[model samples]
Target: MKKKTFVLVVIALVSVGFSAMGQRVDRTNFKAGIHGGVPFGDISDHSNFELGLDVGYHIALSELIDTGLTTGFMNAFINNDSVDAGPVTVEGDFPNIQYVPVAAVFRLYPTYDFKLGADVGYAVGINDGNTGGGYLRPIIGVNVSGNTELNISYVKVSDDYDFSMAALGILFLF
Candidate 1:
């Protein structure tokens, strides 16, 4: 089922990754990105906005590909506070939903200015009642300047329920 699909995809990506190892290797670079998003799925009931910061170190696997490791913090701002318990009115408070993601990055360039990628890993929940989740983010990026890229992605974190978001981000590579 889902687990099998995940494993298959990972295997495919790794095979593709190894193919590029024989080509070229660029200097290791660091990247930082800022992202703003709209949360949906189960998280939408509690949060409306998501803000994230991503930092990574990467080296080109080939002229057309790059592989790296990325880690980031993402916070989903809580908007819901209280809920009704049948005839009783209940007032409660919960902290904002937050996750720290440690992931692997893979990017393929079709041209100098455009690329496609995905980050796959675990999102460790830092808020109450939440443990962690499997994380996946597929992205489309365009080079906006010398070392800057503008990207859009869909982020999904799956635990007991799915936490999904759509985000727009800007990345600076150095």
Candidate 2:
């Protein structure tokens, strides 16, 4: 089910990009960044901090709107010395909970220097399958300098166990 949804999203985004190919537009932007944040909810019970990397491509849809594709890797570092599974208790350290998020991104730029955006997509787990979920992230951004942007975002991932994070990051645009 998750794989099907992911394929559909990729197809839709690709179609949109192709349809926009003939339009004369401002400019497209490519951005990459790193972010760090604290985990909340069920995740907080086991994790202390989260770190991630993101890359995105945004094309101007209008003076005020932009649509794009974004994908990234996020990991929540574990805190417990051991984990209990059913009647069995496993000792020693475990690997961080990791996710790979692939999403459609939309941005509303009220001004050239300020923007609000959201990323809606699926996050796939990399280990132990503890974090695979659907994710929504709302972000606020400011252009601190030419081609440099600073952003703060709240990310919510919904699954069997829901979790959230508050992230601050800087992106370099090209």
Candidate 3:
């Protein structure tokens, strides 16, 4: 019927409009960001906050999914080893811990404005007696603009201990 054809045409037009808007097309996109936060568990005893810069390249697999590779520099700032608790005092040395994470990222966009992803790979140790191990980060983000996003992630990396941190970051995509 003519009504059915008109409805189909309208639906097709709307789909095309969404594609033109910031929807993921089958292409590659790159992003860069800086993230910082506090370390937790065993690593917290030695470091305060960790700061990092990262870059990623993602290939859109569909309108709602992207897969990519990400790499970054993460540095955990060392804390003073002297512990002065009331009359008890102790002193030692704790150096900054540094790592480079190379990860594969898989992101799923639930809507145009929200996303969730996981990054998994190996972290290479750079300094401070850190012999690196696995790296895993799970993240959630909101797209605030056409080319910008805000995200939070829990990062876990292992060396002699689990060097884990929770981080917040803003990313610019291109």
Candidate 4:
């Protein structure tokens, strides 16, 4: 009975020690990655592809879990000619709009080379061309190495058209 009590005491002490050091552990746990990929969607009839770039930082929340902040840039192309102006074909320039997406991200690393996660955030449209409203993105990726990953995701935007985009890219983690 005494032996059992001693073991329990040791386990309790160890658990307390770990919890106390949790902050320290997180303080030293950090990661970053850069990814760029071609996004595909119905933004334009002849757009073909668009460029995307993402840079983010990760804070280790647990052994297999992490939470952090992410910001990304997307050069979105869309065909404006679809909006036919009555009788005349309006020759309006189709500008590539820049999109900046910022979010609070959470990740779950299931394997050494794989991670699955989701992010909730907003996509702010740059330039006066188009102002997209709020956005929600669900992300999935595979880590190529300790500091690199490839990701694919779907982003839903709050707009009159309710636009959505599919993003695919590779990120270099730092």
Ten contiguous residues minimizing lDDT sum, candidate 3:
13-22
Which candidate leads in TM-score? 2
Off by over 4 Å in 4: 1-42, 79-82, 85-90
The residue-by-residue lDDT of candidate 2 on 1-174, one tens digit each, is 875786687568656754664363577889999999888887787787999998998888888988878898998888888876569988986888888888888899999999999988777878875757777899999999999999999988776775798999989998
lDDT by residue (tens digit), candidate 1, 19-116: 54445554667899899999998778778899999998666976787887788999999886774446976678978878998777898999989999
Q: What is the TM-score of each candidate against the true structure?
A: 0.83, 0.84, 0.78, 0.70
Score candidate 4 by TM-score against the native.
Answer: 0.70
- Cα RMSD (Å) between model 3 and the true structure? 14.2
**Superposed model 2: Cα runs more than 4 Å off:** 1-25, 83-92
**How many clashes show up in model 3?**
0
lDDT of 1 at 83: 49
Model 1 stretches astray by more than 4 angstroms: 1-25, 83-90
Model 3 TM-score on a 0 to 1 scale: 0.78
What is model 2's C-alpha RMSD? 2.8
Q: Which ranking of candidates, highest TM-score first?
A: 2, 1, 3, 4
Residue-level lDDT tens digits of model 4 in 32-137: 4443334443354435455666766566667777666667776756545444445856566667756787666667889767778876566678857677555577
Each model's lDDT comes to 0.83, 0.84, 0.81, 0.62
